[model samples]
Target: MTHTFRPRIAASIAAVAVLGLLAGCTGGTAEETTEQTVTFWTPQATPERLAAQEDIAAAFTEETGIEVEVVAMAGADQDQALVTGAASGDVPDVILHASTQTGAWTSQGLLDTEAAAAVVDTLGQETFNEHAIEAVTLDDQISAVPSDGWTHVIAYRTDLLEQAGVEVPTSVTELAEVATTIKSELGITGLAFGTQAGTASATEGIQSIFQAAGCDLVVDGEVTIDSAECTEAAELFLTLRNSSVAGDFDVTSARAAYMNGDAAMLLFSTHILDELAGLDEATPATCAECVDSPTFLADNTQFVTVLDEENPAQYGAILSYGIPTGANVEGAQQYIEYVMSNGYVDTLGVATEGRIPLRNGMADNPTEFIDAWGALGIGPAHERTSVDLYGEEFVGGMAEGINAVYLWGMGTDDATLAGLVASQGVLAGQIEQLYNGAAAEDVTSAMKAAVEEVQASL
Candidate 1:
């Protein structure tokens, strides 16, 4: 089987090169010999999580008599690892990954679409979140089974904003001005968005700006990176960067800067509040306010879905399970159906904060799981929800923001998105040059050329 990457991998080839390099690998246990067993791989590769997965597998075996082996791969490595596994004929029966890859993987002839559809049909299509199911569906084919999702938001200190006497920015232009004002008046970093080139964190921040402004790398097979909207987005990045104290920050440093109180705000996923709740145990001295307790979210933070106009098109990463073509299809189907059914809540409980229930449940109780999610403990304190640590209002805002998610390459072809990924650093590099005294027009011209080059690669 060949390994094909989705558009999501377009900007980060160095991070996902395992897919192309291992496409033709041919070393693995014979599928026929292990027909009674099923191999499963997950992105939750942590030691503790792996142990929990094994236990879940053990339970499945007890019910079906199908021996299962669970393997864990880090989130950053899962895409390429699965590609390598598929190429080498070592593909797992079930694979857990971002739902965004379903169309590409299915198109490459890697997934068992029939079995995927079967799982959804058996589980009742209406039970799953429409958006989550929509994410994995392409060309009328259900490529994977939906699992959970995370909402992206601008995490800011409410107290800081109130003290500055400014409202959260609602448009790209407002974002630049408000951020600059905050930096100047408060003497703190205005925003801590990732600017590190070619990394997922950087891509998330950059793409959020573009998507919010209704700009995309490619739209309807046309490269729009050099468009007026995109150029304006680039200018906004330059504006924010100049005032930012958290220079060249990635996800980690960005989060630290916010948690350390060095920056007033940061672009982050839903997991931020989860970490904040554990600040006392993990990094007691990280923030002065959280030194006494988990007080950051409770007292200071406010999560905003929009950093620009256009109704705040937020970005979210949906997690799903794709069954491979050559696996034990029957066992894999059973496992997926079981996981999304009886084990749904329990499976999500493993990473409650990050894994919001994408499937609400059957009609008799549509919000059974959604309401339950709010009561599950997420941090070291083991409270009902991050809301318990933060506040109901904050968490509610997060849920409302869920519908704002805008995918980067949603309707575009795989090759075009891949081209964009291959040229991911062009804009980032241009932004860096602008920071070092280059003219905005020069940066814009260079970025336009880079966009043309990537489009040509398609």
Candidate 2:
């Protein structure tokens, strides 16, 4: 598969939110120029996203005779390059950026939204999930199509759970009880949390715990993390964090534990399954000793997951192809149009890690992508947990609120806990701040201010 957009490479990044993006609309794009090559930019293409990228690019070349130069940029630095490109008039024909900064990016005119409207009709209102669109939706206009995404789940060692005679909980309370029991009875720490709670692993993956708590980030266009509802969630988060079998979220460390069969439960994304597959057979046996599970949704509450979500929420992202606002508009649009079509996306279904084929019935039966990441049985995956978030509130609450839950559980008082939660937000920007020596205090204070902003807006 060849990418029409510039070539892609996963560049170094502290964290480039892969899913859960909110898109925006801008002035309509221009028509493709007479003859030319289109440039596309993307992070190091993962198997799934890469497969889809190449499928569309190859199709475009075959049909339109346009050659695309794909660029492999680091996830962390893609934004800097993208922003630079947009500013200098050197942006790619299409870009696949993380959804986390989508809102801010759109607000800043970094991306064009009007083009999204041109294709929304063909994409179908139902083509992508609702929240996926909502995240990128601004002022009644959609910026990007909610493409494929992932979700967080409580991956557990099923064999271990059975041996310990402890069943995974469907509810938050049960989840806690199980964690506590695993520790008390077998002297085994039950859950494995990242170094800090709500980091990338938790934010993109385990953050679902908060979602299952019946607390959504946004509710009726209001931010609600500081409210009593999120307070409870905060407490629960702290409790889970303090009780994890391990207290580190470093991907390398977690994988080692998973392979060693030392950790039973992990807050991680569905994609890990594929990553595990790529590992040595001996390494994956530990995961087989375990299984992926989620906080089963209860009978109550309609799920409103984050965009760019890692499952149940299906947070959408754009594996988009774009041309510079004033450059390659036509070519970019044509490239994107071709990729979005059923024919090309359809080809993605069988390319390596077969795509889920976001287009309707295209990948009719679950493809490798769907089989791996689909939220088909989310309700029955793990026990449900109590959540206190809803709607607009979850936005700011996600980064901080989740961390507060972890800190409070770890024994911090209200004031101290609040500061800790605030840190997670700024800490999230660690990747971007990489060039400069980290100023933890300054960053934390800024995060504190941001949290206050969210609270005031709420």
Candidate 3:
């Protein structure tokens, strides 16, 4: 079926001269395909990913006689390539993505929900995370399948806490308290953080506090970051900065610090078990293999899995995939279906932890961790205690405010409650400007305005 893009191309025919020159130069005299070959694209299209892709591709090609060509587009070219391919009518058969960008992309008319939905139905909704599927859906249509599910889980060094005569923390507040104690006892920053600023995973951990602070960055449809609830979340970051062993650590730095055996706990990727493989065995070792303690606060039952309805947060990453609608739709469907089947599930398990999903009737067959997680009421980890995130305006606005509060607060006196309260919206605007290319004062004004609107709405 023709989608909206058919018109965008037809409309572009007005540039016949430019199209003629490019078309002639590339393969003007060569015969084009009458028979179909499916093309696949993904950020994970490395040789390792190809192993999984090829296993299923070979099966499908042998079984159905459809050849699937897997592409490993350059990292910088991924988004551009997708855009170019979509624009040029050469889109891949299947694609993988983090569904958070789905909404924006779908809204801009870059996705095909119908093609993706057909695969999802055959695959079964339960095998995938419903929330992530919902995230990709626009106007009640599915956009992508939950390929690799991840949620933020609390990862702690069991031996260290026990050795230091410390108790494991069950809540964010308690976690902070333990950091303080660990700091004093070990004479090291009990928590490690911020090797660099504005990294993805690091930002994810920093934002988890929004859930824990009992105040999130959003309230309803407005930015509530300046509110008592959200401001407190920023305050917690100030606490982290003051107490953490490594100040302003990036993902590599944080992982290195923790792996080095200095940091006691990290609110990090639960899928870290992948790195943990033979990790404890690494040379000149820094940290021990911290036990997998899926402990949580007494009250909270389920853990947060952002963008993944099934398992959401292993501290903060979205594991998602999709099938492009335009070309070789059948081949795309086959590749996706194969991965969901029993044969390839373990490949995902190897990458993430039990964090990757198991095929239907194979859930218990997954790693021991998944089986244990099934029994947990909260099931492995606790969802952070954020007040609100689903709101459109509020969530985006508050994220900026929290980013400012934490980034400035790390390793500085500005990391106090008073400091966060006074400067949140002030510095939050700077990042807003950086992302949007606006004036600093305007960004601050925008945040203040958004906060005021939130107040009025409340």
Clashes of each: 5, 87, 34
Q: Model 1: which residue pairs collide?
A: 10-421, 10-422, 11-421, 158-300, 171-309
Q: What tens digits encode model 2's per-residue C-alpha lDDT throughout 133-169?
A: 5545656666654444434445566566777798656
Model 2, residue 416: distance off in Å is 25
Native-to-model Cα distance after best TM-score fit, residue 382 in candidate 1, in Å = 3.5
What's model 3's lDDT at 268? 53
Runs with alpha carbons beyond 4 Å of true place in candidate 3? 1-35, 74-76, 195-202, 280-284, 287-315, 346-350, 353-355, 358-458
Decide which is better by TM-score, 2 or 3: 3
Question: TM-score winner among the candidates?
Answer: 1
Write model 1 residue lDDT over 241-278, tens digit each, in one string: 66686568888888788878888887778777667655
TM-score of each: 0.83, 0.63, 0.64
- Ranking of all predicted structures according to lDDT, beginning with the best and ending with the worst: 1, 3, 2
